[model samples]
Target: MLDTVCGGGGVREAWGWWGRTLGGPVTGPDGAAWLRVAHSPVEKAGGKLWTGPEDAERLVPEPVPRPRLRLVRQWTDGGDAYKAELYDRVAGGTLASGPVLTDAPSLPVAWWSGLRAALGLLSAVRTERTAVRQAYLDRAMPKYLGFLDGGGPVPTTAPAWSTAHGDLHRANLVGPELGILDWEGWGSAPAGYDAALLHVYSLAVPETARRVRAELAAVLDSDAGRFAELVVVTELLQSAERGDNLALVPALRRRAGEVWRAFDGR
Candidate 1:
C-alpha cells in the first residue's frame, strides 16, 4: 500500500526517504554511489530537517521501473507521466555526452552521424511558411539581432539547412548508447548548432575539439560558413533562453560583429 502526503515542497524530500528504504545503490558515470536527499524548511518551526521514512510511501504514489529502480510519483495536479526521470538506481555504465568525446578515438562515423542529425533539424525549420517564419523570427530575431552587427550573415541563406537539437550541449547527450535526453527544448535550428555546442564544451581539450570539428567538416559537402553561422545563432538563442547565463551576453555581442563581417564579405 502506498501512502501519500501533501505539502508545499516536501515531495522530493519524501521521495528520498523511499529510495533509502529500497537499499539500492544509486550511481552516475563517476562510479560513486550516492542518494539524492532533499531538505526543506519546516512549516511552523522555520527550520529544515530530513523528512522521515514514514513519509516515503505517502509522497510517492506507485513504484515504476525504468532502466533503474526508480519510483514514479505522480502529482495529482496534471499529466499522466511523472515529473522526474531518475536513473541513478540503474547499474549500467553511464556516459555523459560532452566529456566522452575526449576519451574516444575521434571516429569519423560519430561526427558524420551527428552532422546528419543536425542538418535534419534545420530542414524542418526551413519548411515553415512565411507566417510561421515571421512568428518564430519575431520571438527569436530580437534576441538574435542583439547578438549581430548592423549587417550580418543571416543563417537562413545557408546552403544546407538541417534539423538541430536546439540544445545539443554535452549534458543532454548521455549513456553508452548515446541516448539524447531533455527533448523539451528541441526544435529545428542550424546545421552546425550541435557541432558548435559540442565544440565549445570541449574547449578544455583542444585535440578532441579539433578532431570532432574535422569529422563534422568532412561529412558536409558545402557551405561551412552557413553551417557555422547557424551554430552561432543557435548558441545565442540558447544563451537568451537560459537568462543569458555564463557571460553569454558579451559573446553574443562579439558574434554579431563577426556576422556583420561575414555579411560584408559576401
Candidate 2:
C-alpha cells in the first residue's frame, strides 16, 4: 500500500510510529518523503494535521525553526484506513540515535540551543483547553507528601500551566538541526511538563539524565518543575507496576525518593 502512496519509492528505513502509525524515510519516485499510515476507528487519525508537523508549519511563524510539513496528499482506503505523503526528513534521525534499549546519545550544545529556541517559540501556540489536568500529580502528591498512603508533609499546590509538548522523549526528537516530532499531544500542559517527561525517560542513563536536568534547570529545578517531575515519576512507577519496563522501577523509585526528600526539606 505504501508503494502506491509514493508511487513506489523503496523504503530506506522504517520505525514504529507511536504504536498506531507507520512509515519512515521513503525514497519516493519524485524524491524523499515520509509515509504515515493508520486505520480509521482507531485512535486519532490525521492527528498530525493539528498537532504534528502540519500544525507547526501552519501555526509556528518563521524564525521559529520548525520542520515544515509539505503534505503531498492523503487517501482513505475502503477499510477506513488512511495514508498520507509528506516531506521534511531529518538528517540526524531520532535523538535516540540507535536501538532504543542501548542508545546513549551525546548531543552537542547546538542541539540544546536549538531545542530551547524551538520550545520558546512554541509558547506562541494557543489551545482551547487553557488549563490541562495532570493525572500523575494526583497519585504522586499522596506518596511524596506522605499523605493517606503513609504520612509526612503536604505537597504544595500544583504550579501554573503553560503551552507545551505533551510528549518530549529522545525517540520523539531529532537532532543536529534539533527538530521535535510526534506532536500527537501538543497542548497546554504544566510549564515544565515536556522537560520533565524527557528527564524521566532518561533516568536509566545517569549522565544523559544529568544533562537533561541541567539543560532544563529553568523548569526542572523550580518549585513548579519539582511538581512536574513528581508527576512524571509517578507515571513511570505506574508503568512499572503494569509490567512495562520493569527494569525502570529501580531508577524511578530512586528518583521518586529524591523528589520526596526535596519536598520534605522545603
Which candidate has the top score in lDDT?
2
Q: What's the lDDT for all of these models?
A: 0.40, 0.65
After superposition, candidate 1 runs with Cα above 4 Å error: 1-75, 78-134, 146-162, 175-177, 200-209, 218-244, 248-266
Query: Model 2 Cα displacement at 201 (Å)?
Result: 1.1
What's the C-alpha lDDT at position 150 in model 2? 27
- Tens-place lDDT per residue, model 1, 111-228, is 3464455444334543221111224544555556554545543444444434444445544454333334332333344445556555554544557656655765543323544344
Per residue, candidate 2 scores C-alpha lDDT tens digits across 132-157 of: 46564565656643522223544535
On the 0 to 100 scale, the lDDT of residue 222 in model 2 is 83
Residue 52 lDDT, candidate 1, scale 0-100 = 18
lDDT for model 2, please.
Answer: 0.65
TM-score of each candidate? 0.45, 0.81
RMSDs, each prediction? 11.7, 3.6
